[model samples]
Target: MTTPASSPSPSSSASATPPPGIPDPAAPPAVAGDRITQDRPVPLLRVCHFELVKVVSQWRTRLLLLACWIAPGLFVAAVSQQSTLPTDTLFGRWMLATGWAGPLVVLGFAGIWALPLLTSVVAGDVFAAEDRLGTWRHLLVAVRSPRRIFAAKALASLVVILLLVVGLAGSSTVGGLVAVGHRPLIGLDGHLLAPGDAAGRVLLAWLCVLAPTLALAATGLLGSVALGRSPMGLLLPALVALAMQLAQMLPLPVGVRLALPGYAFISWNGLFTGPAQVGPLLIGVVVGLVWATAATALAYALFLRRDFTNPTDGVPGRRAVTVGVLPLAALLAVMVVTVRTATGATGSGIDQEKVQRSVATAFAHLYRVQTGQLNRPDVTEAQLKATAACDKGGSTADPEGSGNDWRCVVSWHLPGVEAAGTALYQLDVTTDGRFVADGDGPKEVNGYFLVRTPTGDAPNPLWQFDGNVELLPATPKG
Candidate 1:
């Protein structure tokens, strides 16, 4: 140039270079993309929506929803076709009498088996799919916030679980109503439930199950992130549920059993009872929250510290081991403390006076039902004057604690019928104060195992029954 080139205009200079911290667009694509990810902050809601949409759009998810919606109808049809009722299940015998019982029967089945597995089907695959697709690095790059990603995924899983639960409940209810006629239902206490009341209670029972289902879903989500493999993630929560269920069969302390995650699934039985057992319901709510929160927190921490720099790398470093092991160890410590506390509070785990009271009450209600079936005149509980004398394992064993050797002698009288007698019942009492009482009957009073009714043959109300003893301080009968 003749002298010095004219200084570049301020506008041109500004356009040529980004600000001091910002990477220039003209830089290499990888470097520029990295800078953009670091600088950008995606809204949490937007991420959640995206994740949810992704989850729902999957073919597997759609199939699962469809199955949940249609399977119950098929079940009802199959049950209706069968001559013999599925009396072993809680509400199985009532399917023919009332359509409402179909849902309850299905509910009992799903609570034990379907809930954990169905909840896991998607939740377990959510993160593992990313690993399978080698997209963890890409996801991290796009979001740049593991915390936000975890939240979005967890929320998405829970929402999917909710949809599944609702689908099953609604489908079963509608199927039962449409296929079977809406007749009065037999309540757990052997009393008659109006059609409307039965429907309401059935729906409420399904609703009560949501808490535990969600907790199981969270466990699946954690497994997905930790295992980072689709099949393992899918199976871990289900296996855990199976283990928890098996644990329930053990002679664990009542408090410890109640505290277990699986207990929450069956705790909804409290809803069908006359007084509505609030203790189990409250315990379920607390247990579900604790498990879900703990699992999710551990998952979040692990995800945050995960090394996705080398997308295919699987060998965990010492720090990764430390990060994973420390939280699990802490969780174990807390669990140990909780178990000790619960064990200390459990005391003898059975109260004779409470057992007697519950047995007598249950017998009175059920006997009333039996009378109606026999076409006999109605009898009042006061008139029956039901009383029960209960003992734990005979004179040799601890007679005040839980055991299968418990026995109860219940005596009651029928109004206007002269011959009334006492019946002996062998009880299998659990640590939780619930029992299955097998009756040694004066056949005339307690009746046979099955009794004929207008609808069909049904289980006798008095032959064998379930009852619960309240875990309260025993007081002498007045």
Candidate 2:
């Protein structure tokens, strides 16, 4: 030939080697049955599967799952060996009374710390780790579509969190049952739930918490995308959780507190009550959905627009903070205002009638349990006909607000007794529609801190009781 064959052009050279997930159009055709060699786009599910495999292959993920499975066992054993129970927890005081309490107590503790930390560890690192490793470009080259990649990673992170929750719940429940022995659990409404019923409730309670847990995970995902650093991503959700906890303790309006994502963590408390309240559950679901939706959408937007041209892009620390904080703050403020407007002031949540009704219902249930404990004839709640009148604080203080100072006088008709019995209770009411009533007893009926049962001395269900009133707008009577 007159001239040597022209060297392959740079564009042609690049075209010869297509990215991993993308197929080569110039390749020879494969056999009809060989679909693997065909030129086609990768499916979203396949991408998600690859991401999940990548996550599960990591050592930290394996360690996390193992810890989730083992930690609850250790907690149950430790509490069993101790002289003191974790009375501050929702079911902690009943540790010795029923084995089921172990799972519930562990659940309470997990909501406050364990779940958020565990969720963040995976979600927070998922995307940022690639950035840290200078592999984001490589990932982009493989997948070609950032939206598909984001969806896969987000779905994979959710699967990981879901696995963790299942492991923790199963471990705590099975371990508690095996170690502590199955016994009736004292319901939050001052009644006893059989072992089988408590088990169902406990599992359901764990399932209920998944909403907030996932919302927290989505938040971590947002942090991962914005910060582009694993550590910052890991800490963001945890910091947010800490802030929410502090805010919950403050004198915030009922609706405002209900709208916060953290409220979902403790919303399962209503499930343990005799007449299970679903209002808090509904609020928790709504709040969780709002948070998850906002965080995930923001993260998706950030991921799509991220500059993959520079692998070593300097961390946009200040910009990330602005991008992350402002939107979230605006969303929260809007939610708070809307909820407050819809539900009125905090005072509307805890009124005299609601408190009185709640107290009476709790007392009636506990009195039935007391009679059963003393081997007295059985009495139905209808026969008891309980009634209560509660006064919050002295005349000098504002009558409408929630405070530690409240007195309730409860009266109920007791079976096989000529006259109705009366009991006084000192109540500490909170802004979030919860109260603790310490019975000022007639000793014989209310019993002391410990009541005599057929088996042995047990914590009196009537001595000190916790109650909640739904803070939603009152439904019209039929």
Candidate 3:
């Protein structure tokens, strides 16, 4: 018999009509071993390494790093050749006198602009460059997660920033030491520092800038992820830095100023003084960390939600406004509230301690300079035996009140006079630390005057009337 045509084998029938969810043996495999291996998630460390390699391999990155390595040396060389000191900056007046001052000057300049620009070289381009090259898709595919890719790029940028900052600090320190001799540093407190101690303080000062620098890098990265254009990314962060610098110059409330990044940049000045005060430095650290954290988080969110497939699908306007305007508004509101609340709590009076310290320091420096002009090496600040008791508006209870009326009874011995004389000062002091005073002392010191020199090339000098003839009734010392 036809043998029932040997009904198609069950295996053949099953192959022809495979059950649901089962692979067709007759068809090519759905996934090859090579593809399975290729599709495996990349380790985070490996991704970070790849990004770092990609960044380091770029010619521009190499060039920028080279610039960072050499710029400080060139700057120091140029500054060393100058005859006039840059008295406008901290430690600038003493830069020519000691190598220790060189780092301070360089740090001041870097804080103003250089650090931001240098950091932006990598940070501003790290994320935007991928978009410019149409390589985001490839990077995402390899990393398997957008967050991982963003993190890798951001970490790479941060690494570059750290390297650049270290390079700048090292180069500047070495250049300063070489160009200017490593002599004892004269501190802001007018005390001398040993060479080793000075070097250590200078290094510490440089290290203090690390937080602000990282904040700037994070800001640049945020701009890169948000703006998506290399030039805009670079320009925005630099502009923000510049704006903050300008804001620091404004007469804003202390709380508002402390919130600014520019204030953090100069906080290292405390390290150069005797009995270093770390309050501002700590505040800077907190501000920097907050900024870096917020910017990085926002950047990661923006990058994650970005539509790489549709390049024209611009960032949503609401999202942009929320990201850009809301935070700024909140900061401003907080600042206003802080200022208002603080204003009500603060007494309308001068800080007697601050005033005393300022006056003492100012008088000492002035006396020292005046004596130097007269070639009186014997008349030292200590030998003057200057002591003062200050009173504001005839009341010690409200020393914080703002006014032009202040008085101080100062006792000091003049250069050639054996007997110590007492003087009463009719002082006009401003809240901004400016003072104009007329002093009355014993008749023996009528013509004795102190010459006040103005900074820069101005030849005009004023003779300060340090001694007056009339003595006032003694008031109770506060």
Candidate lDDT scores, in order, read 0.74, 0.80, 0.65
Query: Candidate 2, overall lDDT?
Result: 0.80
**Leading candidate by lDDT:** 2
Candidate 3 segments whose C-alpha is farther than 4 A from its true place: 1-38, 314-316, 328-356, 362-478
What is the per-residue lDDT of model 1 for residues 1-478, given as tens digits with 9 covering 90 to 100?
4898889999998878865655466775455644634366578999999999999999988898898889987887679657787866767767776789888888888988888888778787788888888888667766768889999998888888888888788888877887787888766544567898888888888877777777777778777877775477778678878987887667665566666766667776666667766566666666777777777777787777677886644333444346544664465456545644643436545677767877888888888888888788888889999899988766676567677888889988877778766988888876656677787877765647888878787768788776666542333122
Which lDDT value does model 2 have at 171?
83
Q: Find the 10 residues in a row with the least total lDDT in model 2.
A: 469-478
Question: What is the TM-score of each predicted model, taking all chains together?
Answer: 0.81, 0.85, 0.70
Write candidate 3's Cα lDDT for 1-478 as tens digits: 4655568988898769855644355766556766632244678899999999999999988987887788887776568657776755666656655777777788888888888887777888788787778887677655777877888888888888778777777787777778888887756544558899999988888877887787778888877887775477777667878888877655444455556654558777666545564555666676777677777887787777788888754333566557754774475466445433433323222355555554454355445544444446656667777766777888645554335577766667777888876656665554222344444543222123333334422211112321111011112122
- The candidate, 1 or 3, that scores higher on lDDT is 1
Predicted structure with the largest TM-score when compared to the true one: 2
Model 2 Cα lDDT, one tens digit per residue, 1-478: 4987899999999878977665566778677674645544458999999999999999999999999988887778678656687765677777776778888888888888988898778998898888878887677766767889999999999999998888888887777777778999878777789989988898888878888887899899999998886487888889888888897777766777888987878778888776787777767877788888888988888777787896545265665666677888888888777667755634346677878888898888888877877888988989999999888776666555478898988998866787988988998876666778887877865547888788998777788877776666565222
What residue pairs clash in candidate 1, if any at all? none
lDDT of 1 at 263: 67
